[model samples]
Structure formats: C-alpha cells, structure tokens
Target: MNSITLEKWSDVVLPIPARYRAVITRDHKILFHETDMTPFINQDQRTFREDFMMYQFDGDNIISIVIKDMPFPPTHFDTFTDGTLLLASARCVRTDDWIQKNAGRYSLDGECLYKFVLGDGISAVAIDDEDTIWAGYYEEGVYGNYGWDEPIGSSGLVAFSSKGEVLFRPHLPMINELYYLNIQKANSIFAYYSLFSAIIHLDHFGRVQHSEIEEVMEVGPITIINESLITYDYHSKLLWSLKKQEGVYKKDKAFALKDQEGNDLYSEESAIRIRGNWLFVLNDSGIYRVELTMRMLEE
Candidate 1:
C-alpha cells in the first residue's frame, strides 16, 4: 500500500477542557468552544444559556475571545480579516423565535453587533478572503424545517455579504443537500453536494463548472493532492486517490494513514481532515500533518 509520512507538531498541545473543538483547515487554525451555562427558566420552563467563549490557536499562540451575555454556541465559526467574527450553529428547534438566530456577527468582547437566521441544518459555514460568508445546508435546510416557510438556504448554498446581505445563490438544480464546501480565496469555490456525487467549481464572477465522479465515498470531503483527488472512507479508514482520466476521476492509488515513521494509525485515521492539499491528523499523540504534493503522490 502507498503511504505518506506525517510531520508531527510535537510542541503543540491541545488544551484541556476543550469542548466542541474543530480545525479551521483553510486558515491553519484550531478553534475551541466553551460555554457558561446558567439555566434560565422561561414561562414555559425552557432553559437557556447566555454566554460563551471561543479560543483560537494560531500555531503556538492562543487568542482567547470571550463574548458574555450572548449565549450562541457555534458549531462552525471563523474570523474575518478585519477581526470580526462570524459564527453559525446547526439544527435548532426554535426557528420561530427570531431572537435565537442560528448565526450572527459578534465583536471581540462578546457583544452581538448583529444577529440573523442562517436557517436550520447548516452542515458547514465558510468565509472567503473578501469576507463573504458562505453557508452550506443539508436536506432539511433546503426543504424547510423547524418552522421555516421559506428557508434562507433554499439553494443548498448561499453567499452573504459581510453585513449579512444575500449576495449570490447558484441556480443549480442538483443541490438538495450540500456535504462539502471549499471556498479558496475570494475568487474560487469548490463544493460537493446532493446524491449526484458531482463536484462543482465556481468563480467569483458567478461562472460555474463541474466534474462527475461515479465512485461514491460515504464520508469526508474532497481533498486535492497535486493533480489527483483524494477521498477517505472514515468508516473503513481506506484512503483512495484518483486522477482525471478523460474528464472523469478514476481511482489509481490507495493509502492508509501512517505516522511520521510510517506506523499504522488505525483509529487515528478517523480523525484525519483535509484542508486544501494538506491533511491534519490529531490523536492522543498530538497534532500531525502532511502536505499532499505532486512529487509525493508520484513517489
């Protein structure tokens, strides 16, 4: 089996008491979430929280962002170049309550500058280089769920301006559910959605293009390794490589995730994540990474 060795970042330590943590692959950063839970009993006896904190790690430096008096625990979030934070949550049952917006813009001091509904079933949220927010929705989000008569993400993918204005929505008919979204810079976007298994490529000026891959990978996003496409089956932990042969991707090489010394990672492979052409694998041994390049693929 073809294998690639990961470069272990042995110096880095994932902080203890990390809750709802995720790697911001494109930004090469780690995000951690923590909430100050204070149960508030409403008239109907429903409990609610009102404060949260987001800890973002830039390599060895930790940037702690605290937002108090506004409890919006995000499932996906990232900061704009201007340092303004955009955060989003998923699948909320209280869609009728406009105050409990699933997404919002917050200041560094944890003040809610503005709040808006991103609808339900948000699988992914990404902001581009130009600070345009992109939200990817699953099946429930598009078809309308949680008291939504007209879902905000009816197209499965949506682009919003920095101030929360709806900018662009693709008219593609194949989008019933979006699984993956890779917004590279402000000019390019890559997405995989629906049951069609087709990859959509779009430009900043609204140009659209796509390529279909018949082979289905049940899990993980599409990772481009040099000129080939990589798809990992998290269930089986089998990684497959594909090259475009006559306009379609065909599987050629296979791999199993290994350590720096080429040791079997086994269950560790399940935590492997792809951001652009790099693989970020984190386990009990700490964080490890490997850059997928043309030279390494051909080796």
Candidate 2:
C-alpha cells in the first residue's frame, strides 16, 4: 500500500469546538460556528444561539477572532478586506467594526441592508470577481436509488449583489447534492456536488463540467493547491488530488504513511491549501506541509 506523509503542525485547542465546516482565504484564515443552548427569553420566541466564529491569524499566532458578546451571538463571518468584515447569521447581515469595541455593526446604509435568510443557513459565501456574493447552500442529500434527492431541490448555486439582491439561481443535476463549494479567487468559482457515489464540478453558471470520476475527485471537502484540486475522504480515510492545468486535468491518490521521521504523507479531518508544489493542510491539530508533483497520466 502506498503511504502519504503528514507532519504535525499545531494542535491549539479552540475555545469552543465545533464541526470544521470550511476554510476561507486559504489556511491563513478559517471560519466555524458554535451554538449556545441559551433560549431566547423575549416574546418573539427566538433562540438566543451563538452561531458563527472566525479565527484570524498572522502566521500561527491567531491574531483575532470573533467571540460571543452579551445579547447577540455571531452567526457567520468572513473577512473581505484587512479592515472590513462581512458577518451574518440566518436572519440578518452586519458589518463588524474592527477599530471599535468589537461591536457587530454595519457601515453600509440600513436601506441597503436586507434580511438574507438561507435555507438551512448560509453554508458558504464568497465575493466573486464581479463583486457579487456567491452563497453555497448548506444542505445535503442521499446517494444512489434509496435516496437521490438534494436538500435544496433546485437551489444548488445562488448569486447575489453586494446589496443583497438575488442575481442568479440555477439548478444542478437532480442526483447531485452539494457537498463543499467556494469561490476560487474571484474569477472562477468551484462547487462540489455528490452524484451519489461520485462528485462533479459546477461553474459559476451552475453548469456541470466533466462528470467522469477519473477526471475529478469524488465528493468531499476540497482545497485549491496551485493548479490542483485536493480532497480528503473520511470513509476510506484516504486523500485524493486532481490537477487542472493549462487546458488539461489529471488525478493522484494520496494517503498517510510514515517516512523515516514518523510523519504522515497526508492528514485526516483537515483542510488543504495548495500553491505551486507546496500543500498546506490544517485542522484543530494545526497546519502541515507537503511537496506535490504533477505528471501526465499515460493512456
């Protein structure tokens, strides 16, 4: 069996542990949500739940992260610029003041602010090249004949402007359920959907690209490593890679195997961000690095 090597980075225990939803702005930044059991005491019958949290870093020091305040719990958050933060939850959108006393506020006009409620919640969000907001639906579906339905039904990929105007909503294949989706930089967007046993890619227009399994890796969490697409599988517990180079694409299988130094070739339950020949995979345990190679798959 071929083995992949994964070296330990940092296992800094987070203040509140939660599911590793997805990472944004590469391994340099990450986002997660924590729910507090405190019930809303107001007459509105709203649950006073603390939803989202973002951990910021300069290298590995964890410079800043949004924590819970008194009445409101941070729902979802993303750093659009070094000074600006776009934060959200299920009901409302707000801009966080980095210079202020951590007050969750929006400088944008209130008339421009709209109630952006998601189906399950705002799964993933990205500002595309056109300054449009690309939000991925946070839902799942079953595979094969027993259950071949997606959670959002026809709402696979949805696009909106900065002012919260719904721009484009397109449907994907009925069998394909969204797994992990995000915007690559701003020019091109990537969406992964499970067609039961396999995964496929959908462009910004919600059009399915190459459906062949050999052409793309199966549905799992993915990261952009330079020109390659990397993913980790929890079931078989293996790591896979696919390269989309100058008009050509290829695939490679990676796993955890020990070298002379007792390091792993890859990581488990981690997020990988690849640039050039270097790959960075990080989890609660911390970040790791690996060298990658690209070769033509001979027929």
**Every model's TM-score:** 0.85, 0.61
Q: What lDDT, from 0 to 1, does candidate 2 have?
A: 0.45
The alpha-carbon lDDT assigned to residue 29 of candidate 1 equals 73
Give Cα distance to truth, residue 254, candidate 1, Å.
1.8
- Among these predicted structures, which one has the highest TM-score? 1
Q: Report lDDT (CA) for all predictions.
A: 0.69, 0.45
* Model 1: per-residue Cα lDDT over 237-275, one tens digit each: 777778878887777777777886777754642355666
Query: Over 4 Å off in model 1, which ranges?
Result: 10-21, 34-48, 92-100, 205-208, 225-227, 266-270
Model 2 worst lDDT run, 10 consecutive residues = 94-103
Candidate 1 local Cα displacement, residue 224, angstroms: 3.3
**Candidate 1 residue 255 C-alpha distance from true site, Å:** 2.4
Best by lDDT: 1
